[model samples]
Target: MRRSEEQFRILVQGVTDYAIYMLDTSGHVSSWNIGAERIKGYKQHEIIGQHFSRFYTEEDLNEGLPDIALATAFRTGRYEKEGWRVRKDGTRFWANVIIDAVRNDDGELIGFAKVTRDVTERMNAQKELAKAREALFQSQKMEAIGQLTGGVAHDFNNLLMAVLGSLELLRKRISADPRALDLLDNAVEAAQRGSSLTQRMLAFARRQDLDLQTVDLPGLVDNVADLLERSIGPAITIDMRFPARLPNVTADPNQLELALLNLAVNARDAMPNGGKIVISAREATVAGGDPDMAAGRYACLSISDEGEGMDKETLDRAIEPFYTTKGVGKGTGLGLPMVHGIMKQSGGQLVLRSEPQKGTTAELWLPVAQEQEITAPVRAMEVQATPEKRALKVLAVDDDALVLMNTVAMLEELGHEVIEASSGQDALGLLEQNPDIDLVVTDQAMPRMTGTQLLGHIKERSPSLPVILVTGYSELPKDFSKVPLLSKPFMLSQLSKKLAEALSSAAAAPDEDAAEAPAS
Candidate 1:
């Protein structure tokens, strides 16, 4: 019996992964092994006579957890749990613990046998795994939302195109009737507003077509100063702090201006009692510093507002589409999301920082435009009636009946002979039957085959024939950008302009690979 007891004691002392120890009836450490000394950072002599509760944290001790644990073990024969525990040096670690009741041969309780295992690394890894899962879920949710928003916006744009085009044509026909013309003008204005809304939706989906340019940031802000003043009311002040010279940024000037206005309006709305909004700009070099932004030189345009800031929860979801804190009808909730998408498409990022009782700051970071990348702005010409150019036989194609009818009307109104097809396959068949067709205008999103697919077929049959691809969003493949494009919901004059440009360019540069396509 004595030899067997000695072997058991040696076995208990040899365990290095677990802190093995024994306590007296009063919960004082009565025995300690080598494992206990190594794990707890205390010698056996230092801990053997001390109270075992010393291993508990201050919070646990205040809760009387050690007494509860011992009582539970004594009554139930064993107690097991996982929680935070403290070592001798006062550092906390996740611990898996077990306390077994020790009793004499007569079944009277004497003390407890305690065992503890450190599991801090395992707990940390579990937390990291949970975070990764949450991140993946968020990414997938956003992608689904973007896809839905883009599709709906594209369909809305087509509807707006039909409404706007038909209204313009009717207005022209009834120009002499004052009442009729006024009503038509109002209808046109409403449709134009809807068109603008769809554009914002597309922007939020990161699918809008942008007219990118190297813009002078300070100058653009200066131009909108009066507009900003009128928008935010007299109570609010617009403070601009820009240096004398700053690097130009690559962006769509109109869209960037709109994004700025949206942010400014958001800031103005935040400060209901009136406050100063500060707009500033500075140069920054990002080298793996921010996870959201790429490493490059950027012009950081910051807009800050003195208002009641958002809490962490609100700030975290600020860029989610359709999430708003404003009263009913006061906001659409797409402002921040649109700006976020625009910044991303422009090779930049939008960052927002806010704290309770302080203020909110929005940073619009844009890539600096190199000197060679800057393109001179084209001078705009006043819209006028189409010039007396030679009329050509035109093929207009669209799957939507309303859009197709409106497009045919516009083409005939411009004095071009129109032959319409409802689908790409039908258009191809028509081309085969009519070799004399001079040009083809097709909507990009269609059934059977898309506009680019039709253009490819036409290029194979007749590379010199002109083709104009019209779209509501940026759906064209990058390589096909060289093909002429006209945005949807276009006015009569815009369509006329696109037609003339396509024809003239085709004539001027016949050898350009993407300039011409076969109509027949």
Candidate 2:
């Protein structure tokens, strides 16, 4: 009998080191130990016979946590959790808790054995770490976006300045005979093409207005075959493969074609001596496949090039903006990055596969549009008209002296009287002096005042004035509904068309003076 008593004392003392205690079936504190008093800030005399739920918060009590815990322990033979627990002083600490059912040998329920440990410091540290990580991620994302926006804007402006400058020069020299006029025409055409290219860049950068459509993937590829053949040169072979019944993808058809062309150009550059390029399309259902691919029907367009492919490091950073493997002046690192941005914005994904000396394949997965979402009569590019013998007053502005002079010359050659200004402020002054200014043409980014600011001022003063804004920047501030925009690097014809359109719209407006005039 003495030996059994000694063993019981040893067992109680061993459990005292671990905050071990006992609870009745009703969840009352049937017994307490030294460890429980140490951890919970309670004395054995003070806690014994009290409800075990005193260890829980008032919120837990209202939610019947004690009853739920007991029921869980009864059903599963144990209940375990790590959370906040109340102490004797009404303070809370992070706790690791375990409650085990205590049963007699005859299988009758007696009570529960409960154990707890304070872990507040560790829990708080973990929460702080998670918050810090989230903040860092957000900061990095914003920084990356800012860098991309700036790079795109700089490149766009440079291209526009070149085209617009050239067009202006061509306009001034049109009277230099038929040969000179032909050269000017060619220069203007090239500038116009450059403007189209910039517009594509803006589209990929998600800054352009998009007219989304349900596009037949195979048909689009087929249409571009002739253009691809001419653009890629005779050294490269072009091939297309498609399944008969492929799903239509929802996208801007022109943008999609441009994306394909960009990819093809990249592929062409990869193969200096030339190689075979294959364009293929197929329907795919990606359920439980790649995590990035998602679960849905997609139109998969793949472009493969036999060229000097890239390694793992290059491939990893390939989608990053301004990252290029090509030599200086050979490429703008925006090609693939723009493709990536377009895919992301279009509810799709771009996958690239490559290996050094092996070749490269880029796959574009676009979501399939529903039948009802498909619209009739796809939007196609309209043919522009040639400039006619018409004399009109025009106002043009740019920060660069050369660009300003060239634009003035171009407007004059188109049989229009040209007024030029070097800045928005100068342009505003010009507008004030010449109320007969048929069109308000201005550059976007400049010193003193921005193009958007000038546009706002002009709208306020002369709401009926046909204002045409030109920008080399990829991004425009919100609210551009009041004016027509012409991207930089435009041809003389492009300017003419825009001016014509602005005049048309202005003429269409109901004239208050006419309405007030005696019905003539």
Candidate 3:
């Protein structure tokens, strides 16, 4: 029996991965093995007579946990848990612990056998895994929201097209009547506002068409500085901190300008007491270190404000669509989300850093453009005076009846004979019936047959015929750039310009084999 006991003691002493020890009835350390000395950083001579409660944390001791643990083990024969525990040097580690009640022949508890294993590394890994899962879930949820917003924006833009188009045409007819013109103008303004709302929504969904250009960061900020100053009001000073030689970035000049203004205005709003807003930029080389950004050289533009900053919760949700912290009517929560989408679509990322007392900094990470020099922004073609051209038969197609009617009206107003088709198939059937139809103007989002499909069929049949694709949001083919595109909710002048451009191009290039080719 003595040799068996000696072998058991030797076995217990051999374990260095776990701290194994014994406690007296009163929870005093009675026996300490080599494993206990190694894991707990204590010598057996130093710990054997010490109270086992010394191993517990201060809070645990204050709660009388040592006594409770011993009592539970005595009553239940064993107690097991995982929690934060302190080592001899007072450093905390996550520990898996077990305390088993020890008894003699009479079945009375004499002591407790305690075992503890440090599990800090395991706990930290689990925490990281949980964070990764949460991040994935958030990404999926945001993607779903973006899709829903994009769909809604598409439908809304179509409706606005009908309303705004009708109001624009009505204003031309009612220009002589001051009161009627005023009401029409008001209606037009309201419709335009709704159009703006849809544009922001589309921006957040990353579906907004961008006019890409090489933008000089310093020059763009200079151009918008006065405008931003006016928008944010006095009291706040705009400070520019661009390096003398910063590379231009590739982005839509107008959209990037708007994004900068939005971020500036956000900073202005954050500071009610009036503070300096610092706008700075630098070139940064990103390795695969950042999770949100791919490896590339980036022009990092930062807008920082000294204001009451956001808490972690607020900062976490700052880019959520339509989540505003400002007073109602003072803000639209889409500003940040819109900026976020623009950066994403521009092959960049928006990173916001904030602390509750230290204010906030919004960083716009835009990919560096190949062109070192800033190029001039392409100006929109100005609507010229009506030029003499032979009016031709035009086929107008749309799924929405109101939009079709308005489009037909606008076409007829432009002196073109209009034939309306409610769908792409109907448009094709009409083309078959009316072979003389000189041009096809079609909406892209239609039931049964999409505009791209119709364009495909038209190309297969009449390679030289010109077709103009009008859409709220484009999901066209790779060769779509060859085809003329007109965005929805356009003004009459814009439509006329597109018509002229399309017709003129078609007239100029008659022999191109693609259906996207223009007629002779």
Best by lDDT: 1
lDDT of 1 at 57: 90
Q: Name the candidate, 1 or 2, with the larger TM-score value.
A: 1
In candidate 3, what are the lDDT values of residues 390-447, reduced to their tens digit?
7979999998998999999988888989999999888889999999999999999888
- Candidate 1 lDDT, tens digit per residue, 1-520? 9999999999999988889999988899998888887788889878888998898999999999999999999889999999888888988889999999999999999889999888889999999899889878877887888889889989999999999999988887775878887888899989998888788778989998877899889988998889888999999998999988799999988789889999899998889999999999999999985657889999999999998889999997888888899999887778898998899899999999999878899999999988624576653454343443778899999999999999999999989999999999999999999999999999999977999999999999998899999999999999898888988889888888888878876777756654577655
- Between candidates 1 and 2, name the one with more favorable lDDT: 1
Per-residue C-alpha lDDT of model 2 across residues 72-121, encoded as one tens digit per residue: 99999999988778888888998898999999999888999998878788
Per-candidate RMSD, Å: 4.3, 13.8, 3.4
For lDDT, candidate 2 versus 3, the one ahead is: 3
Worst 10 residues of 2 by lDDT: 379-388
lDDT of 2: 0.78
- Give the runs in model 3 whose Cα sits over 4 Å from its true position: 59-64, 74-77, 88-90, 175-177, 371-373, 381-389, 510-520
> Each prediction's Cα lDDT score?
0.89, 0.78, 0.88
CA error at residue 117 for candidate 1, angstroms:
2.3
Score every model by TM-score.
0.86, 0.58, 0.91
